[model samples]
Every structure is written in structure tokens, then in C-alpha cells.
Target chain A: MTTVGEALSALCTPALVVDVDKVKRNAQMMIERCQKLGVQLRPHMKTHKTLECADIMTGGSRRCIVVSTLAEACFYADHGFDDILYAYSLPFDKVERCAALSERLDLFQVLLDHPQALEQLKKRPLRDGRRWHTEGVELTGIYAHCGNTYNCRGVEQIQAVAQETTSFTLQFMEKLKAAGITCKSSIGSTPSCSHPVKDMAQLSEVHPGNYTFYDVQQSVIGSCSLEDVAVRVLTRVIGHCPHRNQLLIDCGWTGLSLDGAGKLPTGYAMIEGHPNLKLLSMTQEHGRVEPISGPLDYSKYPLGSLLTLIPYHSCATAMMHPVYHVHSGGRLLGKWTPTRGW
Target chain B: MTTVGEALSALCTPALVVDVDKVKRNAQMMIERCQKLGVQLRPHMKTHKTLECADIMTGGSRRCIVVSTLAEACFYADHGFDDILYAYSLPFDKVERCAALSERLDLFQVLLDHPQALEQLKKRPLRDGRRWHTEGVELTGIYAHCGNTYNCRGVEQIQAVAQETTSFTLQFMEKLKAAGITCKSSIGSTPSCSHPVKDMAQLSEVHPGNYTFYDVQQSVIGSCSLEDVAVRVLTRVIGHCPHRNQLLIDCGWTGLSLDGAGKLPTGYAMIEGHPNLKLLSMTQEHGRVEPISGPLDYSKYPLGSLLTLIPYHSCATAMMHPVYHVHSGGRLLGKWTPTRGW
Candidate 1:
């Protein structure tokens, strides 16, 4: 039985919790920044995958959203999201579904980068031994990925990669034009989109998904500050092993995610206020935190005490849970369920 | 469209494929080994939360199985499995659900390691604002975690850790006895259980989960042979970048998992039959494989060509997929859907 005062703490251990204030601030900040830059902010629903959060991101407009999976696309589409971009390169197995969704929505776009994908996209076949006739299929736009920007060390490097990616995408658009099929091309990654670009006149849209939930990896890549991290895993200290100098937590790789800190050497995640504690290793259900200084202070983190961790990569961490417990100022707000499946 | 002959390759890119024959073999080998060792093998269903797999593992007995999550416990219980051990230390929030589940099953055990967890266990609270009478709440046993075995270097270290874990568990069991409550105590990890033990008079059963589908991480830890691996991720080469010296695959951190080969210098995963191809990096939907040797032949790996990857950790990798495509001797048999969510 959970009392009203301890509702958040009473949740199951290793639960994914989002600071509502942080999320709203993060969404509003991105919206304003994108507005200032004169580009529409197509929030990637892949991060939160919640209708409530999506409504906040687009200010209830549901104008444009990006999805990583068809399941997510179907979810937002059912929720009245008119313009949805299936940001992944078109896979042959999902062509028919995409085509059908395109017919239903005001705009539904699928990405095309590789030649084989382009060829498959042109066919638009269904898994049920039927192909959508060329005229029946309605594709919103072709999207390109500036995935290499993730490797960029600085803003200048990211900008150069962005230019290269833009040129490459435009060249692919020309190929589509030569094939007698033409559409607007969309391109952007978090790193590339976050970096200032002089020209996006050649592209129809920009999709930067991870900007909504900046993580330790983003900080290491110089994409966002540590203070900008929105989502965190709420966990409990389960045990303390003095011999091993480790503090076991309920959050494991399944909760915190296995994506390591890109350039930061602090380990898997950063404990909100424990600078001396380093998450050195993890199992499926247990996280082992080692002290960077001397022997650990057990009293500092008593058993069953709650601790929040800024994940190494928010996108990957979000995939491990079904719902996000939204909270603000230690008060429980609501729960947001993520669209699951591939 | 998916035709009969192209079933394996036709479904989707980056899908989890299980070799049924290999699973049967792995099951049979472990069962025989445990029989010879004079121990009851309580197979942990956390690795593959499939009823069919569980049936094979338990030899159609449907007697004993271990689960990582309450959802898995419920899954096997609903499928008529009599004994289910939720192999994690008890959390306060789940006490009520655990109590109700205990009422439904012949045996439903929850692990308790810390003093606080024990106090919560003694309380026997439920989520629906009711208290489970101590007499009404039936706990099968207390399970101990030898999680440190994951960090052990070799068989000797694993055995030593096993002894230490067993002793620790026995001490806790003694404490429970002193408190006027007594139950069987269980302790084992894959490493400890796989290694031979002279005595087990103090422990009731061994729970070895990951031995069912061993991976590169298990192989590196000297737990299982690489040949014993029963599952692999089937992916497609989406693009080949000659300038970048990388082969991009449909498998990403989402499919193949972000769990790296612990203690092994190999990147994310080992390419089946492609030793030279190192998984250098990953994004949400793209895995970057760089050739260890000079790479000039794009023809060697044509676009959309299927490739198999032996994951770093089978348990973590399996969690990413909704269903497992069962195959034997290169023939598609059936699809096994995993129970999703917490």
C-alpha cells in the first residue's frame, strides 16, 4: 500500500521516470530554438513514444513527428498525428504497411539511402502476396541519414559532416528525379541538427530525435550540456558489498542501458549527486557501483534509498521500459506508455 | 511478399533467429550433465521466455523453472508450470502482487537478501490496499545471487565465488531460522553451476539461466563453448561505404544489443564466419562493421545480403526482440513470441 506522499518512491524498483518540468523545459527550449532557426522541430517520438508528450512537443498540433518503427508510426497515426516520418531506411518487409499508412495519413514518409532500398521502395510490395499499384501508393518524402555526425568531435566537424550529408542526400534526390520519381528530401541527426547549419533550403525537413532527452553521450559528443539531460532511471540501492567495494542497485543494463559513455570515462551512468560512485559494471538485474576514491561509505547510500542516474544514451535506455513515470518537484504527475515492438 | 521458400530471409531485417536443434542439444547436454552431477536443474526462463523452450528445458515435466521478472513468472504459471522462482531480491512495491501470485501457484518464491527486504517480506503487503496474513502467504524459498561470478576470470575464481555465495546464503538462511521462519535456500549462477561442486547438501536447487543460449561473453568468461551458442541475430548489409572502411548492417544497438564482449577486445559482437569484420560502432538502427584487414571488395558483401551475428550476451540481446524465429538445419520451423513488459 503506497501512501500519497510516497507514491513515486513506492513504484517498482528500476522504473523509468521523467522529470515533467525538465521534459517540458527541454521540449519548450527545443521548440523555441528551432523557431529561432526558422526550421520546424520534428520531435522524434521514438524517444518518449507517448501521445501526451507528443502533444506537448507539437503543442497539440500533431503536425510533424518522427518514428523509428512502424509500430510507433501506427500508434501516433491512430492518435491523430497527421504528418509522420518513418525515419529508418525503407525495409522491404514493411513497404506495404508504410504505403497503407501513407494513404491514411495526410503525410507519411519513409527513408531511402541505399540503392537496394530505393529499388525496394519503388516496388512497394506487401507481405500478403500483393503489391500496391504505383498510383495507389502515396509517399510523403524521401529521408536521408547524417549518421556520421555522431562520430564528430566538435561543432565544426559536425557542420562539415552535415554539409557532406546534405550534398549526399541531394545527390540521391537527383537520382530519384532521374528515375522519374521525385519528392522532398529530409535529413538530420541530433549532432548535425544541433550544430548550426548555414543552409537547409535544399531539404524539406530536419529530424533530431535525441535532443528531447540529452544524455551523457550527448554531453561527451559536445551536442548538449549535462544539465540538459531530461530523463533518468529511478532505482534503489539493494545491497552493499564491502569486500568488493561495490554498491548493488536494482537498475541493471536492462534499466540503465548498455550504451557506454561515448567519451566520458565515468562509466555507464552518472549518479545524480554521488561524484565518487562510478557504475563500473552491470548484469541483467544488478548494477555494481564502485567508489572512485577510497573504500565506499555505506551510510551515504543506505538500503532502499532512491537514486536517479543520467543514462549514457537516453534513446537506448528508453527502449527497456514500457512506460515513463512523469513527475515534477517530487510529486507524481502521470504515466506515459511507450509504443513497443519493431 | 513472403513466399514459402524465402521464409527465413523474407520476414524482416535484424530479427532474432533461434536454432531449435541446437537449443534441444543444449538442453539435453545440460540436463544430462546436471543428472550426472546429482543436482536438479531449475532452468532460468529469463534467457528465452517461451513455453516451448521451457518445456524442452524441463523435458516436458513442467515442474520447475526460474524467472527474472514477475511477468515471466506469471507467463510460465499461466502455462501450467508448477514451480517458479523469481530470482531477484524482493522489492517493497511488488510484495502484494507476489503474495497474490503465491496464492495461485503451488510454489512462488521471492528472493530476500537484505534486512530491509526481510522486514518488507514479513509485512506481506499487497498493492490493492490489503495485507496478506503471514500464514496465508506461502513462500517456496529464499534465493541468493552470486552475481559477482559475472566478473570472475576463470573456473577457479567462479568456484571460489560460488563457495563464498553459498556460505553467505546459508548464513542468511540461519538468520531466518533464528527469526522463527524457515525455508529452503537456493544459490547458483551460470558460472558457478557449470563448474563442478563436491557438495550441495546446504542448497536446494541451482538456477543457471544463460547456459541455454550462451554467447560471446559467456565464451570469454569460460562458461560455455562458442559452438554451444544456440541463437544468432539475422541481419542484412544495408550499405557499404568504401571511403569509411565500414559495412553498415540493419542490426544496431536495438537488435544485436549494446552489450559488448566483456574482457574481449572484439567490438559489439562477432560476425558469424567473418572474423575479420569487427563491429566498430552502432547507432539505434545501424551497426558499423569495419574490416580488421584492408577492405576493398564490396562485392564480397553485396547490399541486402543476410549475415548472422553471435551476440555478446544472449539474455540482453533476446530482450530486444518480440519473437524468435525457430529454425533447425537451415529450415524455418515456427515463431515463438516472448512475454513482453515487466
Candidate 2:
């Protein structure tokens, strides 16, 4: 049997390596945290976007979950995951697919943050002339996103944004009620959800995707510590430019993603256990690494040596790959392929 | 028959729309430019990975191409493309696959920028105990990348780096010759190739990938003009958050990649014909658009209205999609699915 450590040698460069032990711990901690705060942890699948991770996040119940794409909602629904929230403003083009999914699944919901979105949803209906609660389709809720929370400064800033978003969602829900459509209100993002507030009682559930794979960005934002990160891009040293004092890695923007670093450092991502090594820049297939302090021995990072990095944003980085190489105790357990598409 | 413009209404939001007329013009312009310079335009397939685009790039001959990944090499080779160059430095683990491909195709090349990479290639032997060259497989060339030119400030800086890179590559090719393996020297990038350097005669071929769909980044780098860009992300205004002076669109990091805007304005991407509208930020499924000058006139961008934006980096944005919606004369010609995987 090929162990995870051994499998890295066989797999291609710039691959996603998921520590299942870390993943479970991350999932469990978040689940417990939300439980303490009296909120259901409807784990957002946009971060990991795999059935295996979803199962672990939901504690193998597959009862309630959240997704960013209609494709992901259909994927989980097909895999027997019933209660799903398509946690973005509902695209009018996908209503039919959502209706089809809602027909079979126990509950399949979509977000409608704006009144215009609801108007668009109303314009598109089944041939039978029914709207949100048709025979085959029933939207479980109307989700409102405080995406602005991502731009917030600290916990207090996130909390204030969360409070405003919750009020806006409550009022929007009232508009839906006035239209004779009754549905639950939903709100979240990692930062907003991490801050417990009195406004929590207004929303039905919280879906914070990045908590499962706390990235360097999240750590910088005070959502989680760097130690809480569960996923890393395993890359190899390909070349060393002596004059430039740079080490070239197989991980490029395509691997690690070009997600900007916020208040962390002047680089794309951070190298695990290598505070001195900063990813200075990236091309499509080449990541330029420079020592933050100063360069001396290029011999230390020999060609073909493996290096793991914590991405600035886990969702953007994870979306680059087709499969996650799942491992535990440094043993290759299996692979988890994400549902691809919009 | 579905006209291209008509097809946009049916496709999922945030789809890749390729103006084939622009693409043809772009290809012909680069091809003719290379012809005048006395060089072959081995159009890099990394921008548009579809075979149809490759055919157009090769002017229907489909003879030679440059790819970013082994997956692209295998993909094009499987589609009857014979001569292929995996443009980036060959990862050590991919040598076996490279050897296997070289055995079947007329020509299959890889890159070697450093001596260590060449050393790894030396260790990996073909089935019959030959390293690089065997009965069927032969090393096509020693490729070099002027990646440093991407960091260059101006035309002169790029020219200087291009000159240096060519000399470096030529010297490395001589090192291979000393090891009893004769091979050609290859080098190129959009900026270096577009500069029309006298050093071009030293390399066997020029492989400029992004010229096929010159982006905002390329335009800023003096590679091409904004009008030459052929690919765009088609998005719809889903919401207008007046409080934030932002319009929410279906395009997000998942649709329009997080590749930074280099020397461009402080936005994620440039909306074609809408200089006022700046994509300020993005979540996984939400792109926040703001007016660069003043508050966005929400009426100007009606809900569900489609807008196209030129990505900062075409290759990175195109990588996010599985297929390209081909259009010309404001008519949908057909669909082009890119070969996906590593």
C-alpha cells in the first residue's frame, strides 16, 4: 500500500494535500463552537466542496449543508444530501435546475438578497404557473450575505456589519412574507459568524465555509490561528536562481492561486514552517520564492525537495484542483474529488 | 441554429465568451507579425485550451503548439497535434509520462532552466536504459523562460531581460551538448516576443501564449492593446447595493480568477466600455462592482443585464471555465470545451 508520504512522490506537482486529521479537528471545533453559540453549523461546501468533507462537517448525517454553486447543490443532492442551501443570490437561469433538485430532495434553498432577484425569480416559474412553492419546487429560505464583513477591520467591525446585514435580511424577509411567500432568513461569512451577537436569533443558520480550512487570510483577520489551517498545497523545488536569490517552485498561480494576501506579508501565500521564505510572485506555472530576511545557502532547498504552503485564501486555491489528496498520520487514505462547474 | 447572442441568455451566469472574430484577428495579427519577423508563431495553447482555438491558432494546419501542462500536451496530442512543447520547466515526476509521449509523437519537448532539472532528467531512464534519447524518444529542445521580463518596468527593461535569458538558454543548451545530448534552444513570453528583439534568431521557436487573448495586464506591459483582447467573462447584475455604492454580479473569483491587476486601476478587472465600473472585490460567487468616479447610477446597470469584462490575466481567468462560448458578429457560432486536468 502506498502511504500518503510515499504518494506525494508519485503524484504530479502543485497538488492539493488535505490532512484529514486536521480537517476533522477543524470541523469538530467549528461544529462545537456553533453549538455553544446556539446555531446550526450548516458548513459551506465552497471551501472543500467534497462529499467526504461534507459528511465529516455534518457529522455523517448529511442533513443540512450550504453550497456556492447550483452544480454543487445538485451534486450533494444527488449524493443523498437533502437539506442544501445554494448560498448566493439566486441566478435566474438556474431556477429550473433548482426546482428539479427541490422536487426530489427534502429541502433545497436559494439566497435572494435583493428585491430585484426575487422579482427575477418570480418571472421564472414552472409551466404549471406556480412560483416559489410549486408542486416540484420549494425554496427553503431567502439567504442574505454580509459579504462586506470580509472588508471589515476587526471583531467589532464584523459584528457591526453582521448586525446591519441581519436587520436588512429581516426586512427583506418581511417583503417575501408580504408577497405571500414564507421562508427562513439566513446570513453568514467566516468573520460575521465568528462574532456571536444578539442578532443571531433573527437568522435560521450560520454557514462559514473557510472555518474548515482556516487560511492565512483568516488568521490575519483574527478568525482563526495559523495552526487551525487544515489544507496545504504540496509543491516541489524546481529551480534556484542564484543571482536573484530566489527559489522557483512547481506551485504557481494555477496551484496556489493568485488570491491576494491581506495584512499578512507582501506575497501570494505563506510557506509552512518557513517564515523567512516568502512567495514573492507567481506566473501560471512558476512561483518565485525569496528569503524575507536574506539569502545565504541555496543548497538547503535542493531541487525536488517538497514544500507545503498555507494559501492566502483556501476557497480560491482549493477550486484550482479536481481532487484533494486526503491523508492522515502522513498516510495516503484516499482522494476526494469536488463537484466542478457553476 | 442558436445565434451566439441568443445562447448567452440560456447559459449559466459568469460564462466565458470568446469573440471569434476578435480571436481570428488576434491570431492573424500575431501570425503575420511573426512571419514579418522571420519566426514561427507556436501559439501558446494555455490561454484557450480548446482544440478549435488551437486549429485557428495554427491556421487549420494543427501542426505545432505550446502547452502549460502535461495534460494539455496529452490533450492536443490525442486530438492529432503532433509537435508539442510543454512550455514550463518539466517537473521531475512527469518525466515518465513525457518519455511515453515522446515515443509516440513526432516531436515532444520539455524545458530545462537549471542544471538540477537536467540532472533529474538524467536519472530517469527510458525502458531500454537510455536517459533523454532512445530509439523512439528524443529530447526536442532545452527551453528557457524570460519570466523575469514579466517583472520588467518598460520596453527597454524587457529587451534587456530577453537578451540575457536567450544567452542563458543558449549556454545551457551547450551544457547539454557537452553531455552528448544535442538539442535546440527555445524561449519566449508575450512581452519578449512582441518586443521584436534581434536575439530571436538564437532560439528555434517563439511560444507566446497570452497573445491569443491579450488582457489588461498585457496591454499595460506593451504586449497588446485593449482592443486586441478576445476573451471576456459575461456576467449579469444580480443586485445593486446602494448603501455600498456597489453592484453585485454573478462573476466572482471562481468565474473571473483572482489574478491581480498589474499596473491597472484598483479593481479586480476592467469592464469593457464601462471605465466607471470597477470590480472592487469578489467572494466565491459574488463580484462587487463600484463606480470608479462616483456613486454607481444603478439605473444604468439594470438587473439581469449582461456585461462583459476583460480579465487582468486571460490565461488565469480562462482556466476557471470548462468551455468557451464562441461568438462572432454578435452571433453565437458554437461552443468550445477545453481539455481539463493537470
Candidate 3:
């Protein structure tokens, strides 16, 4: 029922609002970064699974995207997206579905980390002349996730991890070539992809998802600045619990998620423009907010007043919302409904 | 695409399965307990916001229920449920929508904890000559949630908190009566209601959710036993990370949520029938699970094998799932879709 052109304040509280301008800028920057690196940018859709965001991330090509679940793989494939990669370690129970996608899509890829998974895939061969592998199971490629970069404090650490992953991956690819089993190689993480090293240019492709919607964690890790975070949970002050020295907001764990707990100076999320205010805790549908240093000024935050929260993790927060209210400069554009479930 | 009479193992990984028989038993127990106490059992729909579960919780009467969000209120109202109480401190931004529901429903109630919220309600009087108050905004009642009971470890501690809350509520009701403002008084929490003090019978109504789908958190708090818990997240072991001494599962924070972190020895949730295993960490789509004390015997859990996860908090876990695969004695019955968003 929320229409276009309305101010963001008109929407209900605890709404996830996406700054479309920032999304486009972020997506464009990633695209340009990969273009410069001479590697394909296979954007991951696990961060924001909506088709509209997928279009933005892929520059409307709708090709060469990595998905975390089969549901996403099918969703995008059904929407004309081809060259999809089911990036998680292949789930054994979903081989049939994976086979269907393999036969249907022009280039449906799957990842496996064990021999048993490969056997499972072998048992379910695609029909209609589709082949998942070239003779004996094909070595599709080597994919490494530099997830340790998440613990990095800044760009220097991130690039170090990226460099190590690239060297190791390149070394493995050389060994594969020597064994006469040459295949493509790819490595990624938001931190590593956001600040790629010179060595990463040697890779075949890079798949990073979270860069499209930068968040407080990304800012803390020096992947992007606070200004680059594209999404915010727009909540409103609903109650004043003077006795507890807390102000209640409509956003809770359901709205913002329990991601980045104990990692933030603020309890759950960073209150934009209000560094002293900490989102102390949350229940099912109520978030408790309080000042970090001193007593709160109740007169400053009256009932129904809007408070913007920069989420600690955009992927986690975005999953809580069924639809994202797309906006540009505080004016509503429309909505982007994301696909859910595995 | 999932159908009835199918074994749970036939479904894909990371599916939330609810035991229908357990749900009926839990609902019937709550109804009988409240009936014996001579109090109106207005079950809460926040835990499982599905019409089928709501039907089970309300004993098929489709009347007298509580919801945590306005969307839930509207959902139940649209489905012909009546006498609804939105058990939330009145949100100022939702007053107009609340007014519409107030005018449309046969009996819709809203909760307000502040004078400003009351003022906002007064500004928007109900149409069709339906008055929210007889004169000067008549007192509706007092409602208290003994959330502190969540901290209790046993039935004794739970009843102690329940007794204290009931005494305080009765004392406050006496004060309201002394002030010549007679109205209904109600109080509830899953733990408190599960083991109600004798004095709770004197109250006009009680609202408790989560009993229908009791979880590990409630079981730990002595609200119910492990056998009483009705929900389990069905996941499959997708990989064996022997170097890291872990098994990867399809249930991540997105599948089972991060609500009970550090609270359980099993990490995020209790892996049913595997007391020795711990869900150490999770990424977006993968959960790293390992043995609690020693190296895991990976042979015992091959890839494609199913693992049952009893969530720490059913409300939190239920929120993560888009559909609940209802089953009876391990045979799938149907899917129950819950409402989302505020």
C-alpha cells in the first residue's frame, strides 16, 4: 500500500529502506573494479536476493551470478538469468533439483568439496543431452572464500588475505595444469573484493555480494566508509521508559536481526548521526535504545520521531524484511521483494 | 511444491517441520488449564502467525487472540478472527491503520503505555459512530508480561515470578477500583502461564504463546519438557570438514537464527539426538558443527544424512522460516505460511 513519491516518513516503522542511488553507485563501482582487474565479476545474490537488485548488481545482463541456495538458483533461472552458480558446498539432498537446473539453464554450475558429493552428482545425470561434466566428472574450477578477511581491521589486512588466497589459488591452478586438468579459478569475499590486490587480476572471476549494500561491519573493516552504506532500518521511537533510562523503538531482532552482537559499540546497530545512542537490546518486536555516556534527553526524541539505523550486517538485516522500500533522496521509488527459504 | 504424506527426509534441507499432534496437544493443554482457572485464554499469534496454527491455538473458535504486530492484526482480522488485542505499546505512526481496524473489526483492542499515545488515539475517533470510549476515554484494563520468568530455571521459580506478578496486578486492579475505574486485568508469559499461580484464576484473561511450538529455551526455563517441543529444523549434512574437525549443515543463522548465542552449550541450537555435537559458527548458508569434546567421527554422519535441530527459541526460529512444513509422526501434512512485516 506504500506508494511511490511519498516521503520515507510516511512508511511504517521498522521498514528496510534502500537508497537506490547508493546501490547503483556501489554496484557500478564493483563492476568497474572487476572490469579494470581483467576478471569476470560474478556477483553473489545472497546479500540481496530481489530480481531488481540482481539486475542492478549484474548491470542488467542477468548472467554469471552466484547463488547460495537452489531456491535462488531457480528463481533467477526462471527469470531469464543464465550462467548461474550454486556456490555453497553442494547439498546432497538437492541433487535432483540441481540436475533439473543443469538441464534447463545454459550454464548451471555447482560446487563440491568432497568426493561423496561428486558421486551424488554422478548418480543424477542431466537429461536432454545436457552434461554436468566432460568425461569423468570435470574439474569446473577452484573457488576459495577468503572469509578470514571478515576478522580484518582495515584494508591492509584485507588485501593481505586476498593476496594470500590469490597466490594459493594460482599455485593450485598450476598444479592442476601440470596434472592436465586445467580449469578456471575464482576467489572472493566482500573485504577482499572491495579492496582487491594486484594479484587478484590473475584470477578468472571474483564473486562478492555484500559490497552492493555496505554496512557498519564493512565500514569497520574498511571495505567502505559509513557514507557508502546503502540500507537503513527506518524505525520510530514508540515509548519512553524513563525508569529504565531507555527509549523503545519499533525495530527489534525481527527488524534488524541479532547480527554483529557484542561487536558494535552500540549494542545491535549504529544510530546514524547519533554516535552516543546505543541500541542496547531487542526482543521479538521491540528494541531498547539508550545513551552510551549520559542520561537521554527525552524532549529530543518525541513519540513517532524517525531514527535511522545503519545495520551491522546488511545481509542479515535484509533477510528479516520481506520487501525493501526503494528510495532515492528520501523519496519512495517502489518496492523490491526478495525470494526467501532454501 | 512439498505435498502431504511425504516423509520429512524426502523434503529438501533446511525445512522447518512442525509436529501437528504435539501442537494440538499443547494447545489443548493450555485451553484446559485456562478453562480450569476460569480465565479467558487469548492465545498470542506471534510465535506461529499461520491461520492453521491460530485455528489450533484458538480451539477453532477464531476469537480472542493477541498479536505482536499490526500486520498480524490485519491478517487475523481479514481471516474473520475477532476480539483481537495488539499487545504492543501503541505506535504513533500506525494509529490511522489501527483506527481502520478498530472500526472494521467486531472487537479490536490496542495497547498504549504513554499519555501521548492516548492523545494520538483521541485525535482519530472511530467512524460509523463506533466509540473507542464511552466517555472521556474509558479505562480498558491493565496488562503485564512477566518476561522475567524467562530467566527462571524451574517451575518453582517460574511460579514465584507468576505469583508476584499476579499479586502486583491484583493490587493495581484494587487501586483502579478504588479510583472508581473498574476494568479487566490480565497478565501472561509462556513460562508464567505454563505454571500459573492459583491467584491467576482471579484475573479476567491470560495470553500466552510459544507453548504450541515449545523450544529449547522454554524447555530450559521449565515451561515444557524436550518432548513437548513441537518444532524442529530439518537440515542435512552437506560436507565433512575433517581438517577443521567439523561437519557443515545447511542450517545457518538464516535457518535457525542467532537468538540463543552463548546461552546453550550446543552453540546456536540443540542438535537433537547428538548431545556431543556443537554448532560452533555459521556463514550465510552453512553451519559449522563439531563434536563438543573431541574429534568428530565423520563416518557416523555421511553427506546427505539428515540432522534434527531443536531451536533454542521457537519464536526466533519460526521467524526465519517462510513456510512451516506441518507433519504428524514424521509424515508431512501440509505447509503453513506465516505473515511477516510490521
Per-residue accuracy of model 3 over A1-342 as CA lDDT, tens digit each: 678899999999899999999999999999999999889999999999999999999899999999998889999998999999989887877888888899989999888887878788888877888887744857889898999999999989999999999999999999989988989999989999999999899999999999989999999999999999999999999889899899999998999999998998888999988999999999999999999988999999998999999999999999999999999999999999999998
TM-score of 1: 0.84
Segments of candidate 2 deviating more than 4 angstroms? A1-9, A35-38, A127-183, A191-203, B1-7, B128-142, B147-183, B195-203
* Candidate 3: tens digits of C-alpha lDDT, residues B81-160: 99999999889889999999999998898887877888888889889989785346588888899999999999999999
Chain B TM-scores across candidates: 0.87, 0.87, 0.99
Residue B257 CA error for candidate 3 (Å)? Answer: 0.3
Provide the interface RMSD of candidate 2 in angstroms, 1 decimal place: 1.5
Best by lDDT: 3
CAPRI level of candidate 2: medium
For candidate 3, the lDDT comes to 0.92
Compared with the true structure, all predictions reach lDDT values of 0.78, 0.79, 0.92
State the lDDT of candidate 1 residue by residue for B161-239, as single tens digits: 8888878777878897887777777676778877746554467777787787888877777777889898999888877
TM-score against native, each model: 0.84, 0.87, 0.99
Poorly placed runs, candidate 1 (over 4 Å):
A1-6, A92-94, A103-106, A114-116, A124-185, A191-203, A219-227, B1-6, B125-185, B191-203, B221-223, B261-266, B340-342
Best by TM-score: 3
lDDT of 1 by residue, A230-251 (tens): 7889888888899899888888
Model 3: pairs clashing at backbone N, Cα or C within 3 Å: none
Give candidate 2's chain B TM-score: 0.87
Alpha-carbon error at B140 in model 1, in Å?
7.9
Native-referenced DockQ of model 2: 0.58
Lowest-sum lDDT 10-residue window in model 2 chain B:
B128-137
